[model samples]
Target: MFLRFGFVVGQAGIIGTMAIVLFSNAITLLTTLSLSAIATNTKVEGGGAYFLISRSLGAEFGGAIGLVFFAAQALSVAMYVIGFTEALVGYLPDGTSPTLVASLTNIAVFGCVAIGAAWTMKLQFLILAAVLFALFSFYAGAWTQFDAGIFLQNTGSGFSGGESFWTVFALFFPAVTGIMAGANMSGDLRNPARSIPLGTLAAVFVTGLIYISEAILIGGCRDRETLITNNLVLSDIAVMPALIAAGVFAATISSALGSMMGAPRILQSLARDRLFRWLQPLGIGSGANSEPRRAIFVTFLISQAGILLADLNTIAPLITMAFLVTYGLLNLATFYESITKNPSYRPRFKFCHWTTSLAGAIGCGIVMLLIDWQWAFVAISLFAALHWYLSKIDLSADFGNVTSGLLFERTRKNLLKLEGELYHPKNWRPFVLALSGTGFSRPHLVVFGHWLTSRTGILTLGQVIQGELDDRHRRRISQERMLHAMIGEHGLNAFPAVVVASDYVTGVEALVQCQGLGRLRPNAVLLGCPLSVDRMKIFGGLLRNLRGLSRSAVVLRRTDEPADDWKPPSGTVDVWWRGRANGELMVLLAHLLLQNEDWRGRELRLLRVVDNEAGIDEVRNHLNGLLKAARIPGVTKVVVSKDPELAIQTTSRNAAMVFLGMQPPNIGDEEAFFYRTEKLAGGLSRVVFVQSAGGMRLES
Candidate 1:
């Protein structure tokens, strides 16, 4: 397909193809660096394209771009499938055309490939090998017909303009588009930090070498003018039309598969964020790679749709636009990180000066804007829409999976806060949120408490691995490997830096206390309840002592709904609200209403008060006054009463929930008292508690 569609770089000269390679290489490098910054700070998940960008940038922004990327790939894949199959059918009896057969065959191929990894892997390998071989052979053919003089003869490509040289760059730009095939696989690779950057760099260099050599070879053709003007496949000179067309067929197939593979990952990433519910079924929160079965299927269907919409002629422009959009963002991300002096960010790999990348991106964006204004407009419009959606969206509820790394665009500030290096007025480690043990709940608990304070914390997972090493180097490495694999596989790439400490370590007291750690402030430490009694006692004592050393905090308890979904009584989102230590919970009703999308951006009214007696009349009178304040003619009001029993009555009288605070027990038995609270509110209404314990300790 490369040869047929004029993707083969011999369509131009060495300089022309080299230009494309340079741009692709630079763009790929920028993207890799951005992704690396995100990966180092957060664990990567299945949404290969969406994962890194969202983490580095923010999920909302990431989700928006993810949707666009997914759409582009889906469309590109269909184009490839339809085009390739149609060509395959051309080999049938002279009297018959095989387009329909090709479509059916391609659909079967899609089903078989998407159904399982084994088949997909096998097909990918075969396609890759065939294309690699064809590319090699084609380059070899070009060398056999090398022409240095021809390069100089038509360097202008017959375009009579002072900017003719740049015209050549424009003509060969589409060739650079294929480099995304390698870049898009960042999340799938075993070692993305190392392999993603290396593979992309290698792909760029090799592609450049092949393209430049081919350009020189084909440029020197005996009838260079004919090849340039007629747009004929390079093989017209060699007379082996069969072999050349066959090679084209292979390359096109490879391109299509590559596009298909890439698109779904981006879609899957978006779905992971719950941005595109339609695609969520594909990567549906399961499988090793979070395969996103439903998302992949939707992508495949979308691709087929695109294929139907576009024929051989119109598809090229859209695909080019997609590539340009990605490249432009890549350069922009690199530039931002570079100027900001972001940690671990380096521009060393960029092929040219920073200005060059900016220039290239601008050029690409301009060309795209000029070619298909409507499509470009649609893509940009959707991206902006998505970013706005992300900007306001909060993912604290899914706190475990989100890395603090994405919290800010500028990096240096975050590095200090994340690494536990910052100092408050009463500084030490700001607050030690001990991730008590290894379990599904650990990351969320630790990150949450950490968020509450400086996030200078640790999460200890007492995992039952197949080993018996005690803080041994090998054990640590093994754990890291396991964690890396599990984290990536589980798509928890966006997580804080976790140090898997030994459970056998006799005392976590010193570590938890941040004892004698010089200026490294460790205030109060948080611990979970699942540990052995003896262990908790020891850790609890240490926590108390640490408080003496520094004003420490301890919110020790188990979740009432440990492994269950939590729905607080309406806008009562359990906010440790920034301004007010505990803000009005009545707005929770607004939040509940906002969940319906149709009324999200509306004004809200909430009922708030302070009570000491917890009396029924006091609550009802206060609630009634609050309800009066909420009278907005057409708007709705939901009140979650402060008293559980009264709240239940209110719910029956009018839709409402019972909101209550966790009352620390000193007068009565602790367990019995909390258990009574649970029993009391069990069925009255959506009884809720502010999660003061299991969350990232807020820095402020």
Candidate 2:
């Protein structure tokens, strides 16, 4: 208040400066309330704001903001030390350098913090008493000098220094940013959740009243020229100038000590999480209470760098930008927690609403830009880069975060909305259920299903654990995890579903019927081509059941090539257009496959075999027209042959994958149908026998 209050009053005048103070404090108060809500909801530990944010927002978000917040706190030490130097410089000998004074002040603060938070906190009481005494003296002296005419004159803004309202706002925002100082000391507190909200809120209210009263009193008593030219006007207006000087020393040093203590704890928390390898050494605590001595040394070095900058205003905006970023993210985290309605987010502090958090976030962002757009851009960009880097590290948190809850809420709403919309062929997307057992065992089946979906649709890797639910419940869970790990290992965009039943057939049936939710339910079922005759019979039965349920089925017959040699298919995808019943679905699936990066440049060939050459031209023309109508890139071929299966083998021998239309066998002819499919897929690299159960279309 002593350092920048006069500057703000000078630039924005009495009313404008008071308004900025009120606005900044109001935003701070709302943010504090949001912090209170989150703090009360969980068991907050040592890291204070960092702990709360990381626990609520997940590791990546928390880690990134944690580092940024640490930087803000470390630099704040320099800002406050510079303020202390400014106050002490007036009493120093002639020609004493302000930078030298700032350096010394920083060292003193470092020494105080090095002694530990207990000793530093003990000093805060004396500092608070001095500050209160200073405020009393200033108000007492200001009342004697106050005149109605001067008060009226200073009420409106007079921009003589070419300073804007936002610039002044930036100077004053740091005063309220200290509300988190107590939160940063959460580790040292007896009960963080209870202490943080009450203590921090009370500090905000009391300080806000003090700041507003001081602004009004100073502006009413002092002339504009004096306010603008003098950075130490408070001392001149005090009943005892020496008391005001003591207050300046006390307030700035107290803030510097607070930052010095808080920043290291934040760094220590980050190091403890092992987010960055180099920070691991700093994670080690020195004593019984786990003091962050190493982190303190690092923070001291950063503060010394900040103090070297020498000017309070220069360091002030940088600290403001960092704090705004941290505060804005905190608001967003709280807003997500509330909006998602996560049951675990129940807070004893109910005064905060989601809208308040939203408003606080938006207000912080707007203030950041208003103060300095270039700085805000740099700050936001740096934050984004850090977030991206942390996300890439794949950090995991032990506690639940709002990200999953937010996604689940959004998915729930979209699913319900989709449930109400009428289905249309034009809007159709393949929702595939790949019954690939453990997925790792039949990697080809899972990979093919993912390629078929192409991320525009949903692909679920389903496993059927054969046993009773009570007997194999744990196995089902383990297999589900394995399926998910398989998807991650293969880098496939898919979901996993595992079920336990008495037998393979029952498990498959259960998966087919209950794999997805609402409109997101699977429309296509993919399974590997059975190797044995008995398994083929079961596969045939499954196919019949799927057709009866109007679900398209894809049977993948992989070659005997070694798994090491197997890779994403790269050559042509041949589609044998036997009839519209399966041809359309086959064409659509091929198009979807080509959408994936693995099959991005692969060719699509639509082929048909005619018994004779009499109508070959007509067949070719129809295929070309179909491709044109479908707006899919592919070549057309018409082959004249007596045997259709032989023609397919001869034409697509070297193709990457073959898509053929198939019909389910009659009730007692599963053996014959299986033999025919085996013959058709003979010597093929990969064959996918597709049977459409109607409703699928290529052209709407």
Candidate 3:
């Protein structure tokens, strides 16, 4: 592709343009160094690039890249087998067909791999020897015809084939990618940590030197027109043309055999982690050495179909993008580890630096876009989608994913910065500790917690398992697991936490006082109102404790029945404005809920109940001023009624939720206040009495 686009120097001028070999190898050299750095730091086992990335960046990213890497390797198998077939057909008698040769070659390669990785690896040595001999013969023959004066010939194609330098780079870039052929055998090696870096880098250096030599040979030995017209210039100039053919066959077959062994191992690793549960069958091995024979058979089927159906040019760009993306991610993973300066990042192979990893990442990205922006975007999008899917699966693996460590480091730094800063009401976000039993029993309560903390803050669902102190300790682990499963089943972002206590009151007291590390301590508490008055007394006591702790509280009670379909509440949110702290907190929460996409178009009505018509205008103006200053988009109203409970019920009957202010339940003999609160929410959907301890004012 590069030669057609005028990117390459003509054969006679290749000596001048030999830097292309350096340029290509430079990309791999960066990857090799970065790979070596990470491999040495971590205990890398199988999955090759996938294992390294997942261990650093986490499964979602690792799984996504693994999918792409597997495809690239599998397609490489087809590409190589077809390459061998092309060489064989080139040297065959007139009656031989290319398709038949390709089919037979694919079968042979697949059969060798099916025997297992042990035999395939053994065969590689013999193939490598043939490859070396062929290279020797070609160089010897080329040197006999070589002339230094040929370097001065015109090498530009002048867009003869409507291709550019980037297109050429894309085509030839895959040639330098054979470095991974050794790295992919990491699973088979007993000491991948020691061997991968040494073996991979050595191959890269040797291959690079060979490529540069070939460029010089082609430039100095062959004519420009002849090189331009015939890509088989190596065969033409070789001392024995047949040796060139034999080398091509050996090289392509070796690559095919390598991929056949490597790709399945990736699939096996992915399945072992249950990243995609449906793919678990691929992880089952049939050999005593745990050869991925099942995975191998699957790989063979995929390659066979590609060999028969795919065109080489069509598959080339895809393979290029996949490898480029993998290389970029690998570098990014190492760069993250280095920059974070995590104490765990010490590598046995210490030659790597953060700057090099970053450069490698940037180089991979730039080349991906430069080669073909369209394909680059497509490949990136596909990986992003895969990551999203894997994240949803919540594949359980302890890869020591780097994101957690990065978060920890950043959080520590931010906490240190925050220590010197003064606390402000404007920065207050609801870090809520919501008490609940089961989501199935209290669906509305869970949904309410989600809405309150949707995008702005953290909401942890705290479940207190009441039992004898001794037995509670024994059952805590099992109970926590069940609680976590419930949280997962409900698909809530809210964390599930369980604590055991001797009694309900003690449990509530402990949960209310509990605090997470650093700034993660809960600033608010939420709970569903109990049906019985006795149960209400228990919640009332919890509220009193929370008030003393200076934590905001929300007690919710559903007065209106849920829809028969039982979907989450969605509609208008009504907030009753009293004044100062309580009103501001209630309105702020309602507005925060509006910020979510689900509640975007929903109404937020700020309502005030006045005793008579005389105070109606004043209240409306005050409420309007508050709304304007707070910048909360909502309607304002004043209801002049003798019975405020009737007014509230009528105004917010169809609303999704109603927020009402109550005098601190623990402060006064608020039986009348409590009675009126229940009466007001009698006909409303879901009513929450919000009490703000302090720090509730808007920025004004």
Which numbered prediction scores highest in lDDT against the true structure?
Answer: 2
- Please give the lDDT score for candidate 1: 0.49
Ranking by lDDT: 2, 3, 1
Provide the TM-score for each candidate, comma-separated. Answer: 0.54, 0.61, 0.59
- Give the per-residue Cα lDDT of candidate 2 at 281: 94
Stretches > 4 Å off in candidate 1: 4-17, 36-41, 93-102, 147-151, 160-171, 182-187, 229-232, 237-241, 277-279, 285-290, 330-374, 390-700
lDDT scores in order: 0.49, 0.83, 0.76
Displacement of the residue 592 alpha carbon in candidate 3, Å: 42
lDDT of candidate 3 at residue 654, scale 0 to 100: 82
> What TM-score would you give candidate 3 relative to the actual structure?
0.59
- Per-residue lDDT of 601-628 in model 2, one digit per residue for the tens? 8899999999999998999999998876
Worst 10 contiguous positions by lDDT, candidate 3: 1-10
The TM-score that candidate 2 achieves is: 0.61
